[model samples]
Target: MPHTPGSYTTSDLSRKSGDIIAEALRHPVTITQRNKPRLVLLNIEDYDRLMRQSDARSAMTLETMPDELFGEFETAVGAYADSDEAGR
Candidate 1:
């Protein structure tokens, strides 16, 4: 299912909770309080998909990197550490 961002007030949500949740299955719904956005309603699948994407983006294994590239990385880290110490 495809979804677009939609905003709703708390009172509005309270009155139409079921419908709102149904809509959330298709897209994220922003809950507002005092006319300001506060919380989001979304399907569990959407939540899981987002978490998976985050994990994929953060997946890094230095051990899998080429030796030459990793060597340069080590050198860069050493340089950065030296610079940080100098700044202290």
Candidate 2:
């Protein structure tokens, strides 16, 4: 379930569960029990997108990337410095 920006009591949900579900499909619905938020309902698409974004953010390797992957950048910089010195 996705969590919306506001709180909805369990009783409120019991009374309007269908509407709550529809709203959840569009965004997220926070479910509260005992005045405390307990769950969230999110649309599948939103959930998938969030998961993918989180995975992308957590995935990393550029800093630890093998030198071969960025050797061209160093080579290009070296060439530029050499050319600048020759021009001077």
Candidate 3:
């Protein structure tokens, strides 16, 4: 389901636990107390998806990339140095 997580105060959570949890199962829900966000509620599948994405990002390494990609990366870097935004 497509959903954008919405904030829920502690009081709100306590008053609407079922609805809040059901919403959280569809998308992450922000839990707040005293106007400060304290926690996130997400379903297991979504949590696992986040973990997998994080793991993939953490495991990235340019050194392990193919030679063609490395060469293209180098070319892009050189182009950056040649561009007007290098100093900025």
Candidate 4:
């Protein structure tokens, strides 16, 4: 198999933990087991940033959504209701 940068096997993790962790502090690293990607190692800052980005994307209130998006959502709901009534 081709070697991948920032990827290490389980055995390499055991033997070179310090080096791997140092690299992870600079950028994310992938840990592999049986040649399959298993885990990611990253610095706390990167992890926190990723979590914040995920929360921002997933947790949105109608009050926070822009007017255009709210209008589109309203139209979609209205269409769904019309379809349901037609089916009934």
**What lDDT would each prediction earn against the true structure?**
0.84, 0.79, 0.82, 0.93
Q: In model 2, what is the error at residue 17, expressed in angstroms?
A: 0.9
Worst 10 residues of 4 by lDDT: 51-60
lDDT of 3 by residue, 1-88 (tens): 2223588888888988999999898888998887788989999999988888784433447979889978998999989888857677
User: Residue 86 lDDT in model 3?
Assistant: 61
In the predicted model 2, the residue pairs found to clash are 1-40, 1-41, 1-42, 2-40, 2-41, 2-42
Candidate 1 lDDT by residue in tens digits, 1-88: 2223577888978898998998888899998888778899999998998988784434458978879978998999999999999999
Ranking by TM-score: 4, 1, 3, 2
- Candidate with more favorable, higher TM-score: 1 or 2: 1
Backbone clash total for model 3 is 0
What C-alpha root-mean-square deviation, in Å, does candidate 4 show against the real structure? 7.2
After superposing candidate 2 on the true structure, give the runs of residues whose Cα lies further than 4 Å from its correct spot: 1-6, 55-88
Q: Residues 1-88, candidate 4, lDDT per residue (tens digit)?
A: 4549999999999998999999999999999999999999999999999988784455679999989989999999999999999999
User: Candidate 2 has what TM-score?
Assistant: 0.52
Model 2's number of clashes is 6
lDDT of 2 by residue, 24-82 (tens): 98888888887677888889999988988784434436687568856876788899999
Model 3: lDDT of residue 9: 86
* Rank by lDDT (best first): 4, 1, 3, 2
lDDT over C-alpha atoms for residue 9 of model 1: 84
Query: Listing every candidate in turn, what is its Cα RMSD in Å to the true structure after a full C-alpha superposition?
Result: 9.2, 6.2, 8.3, 7.2
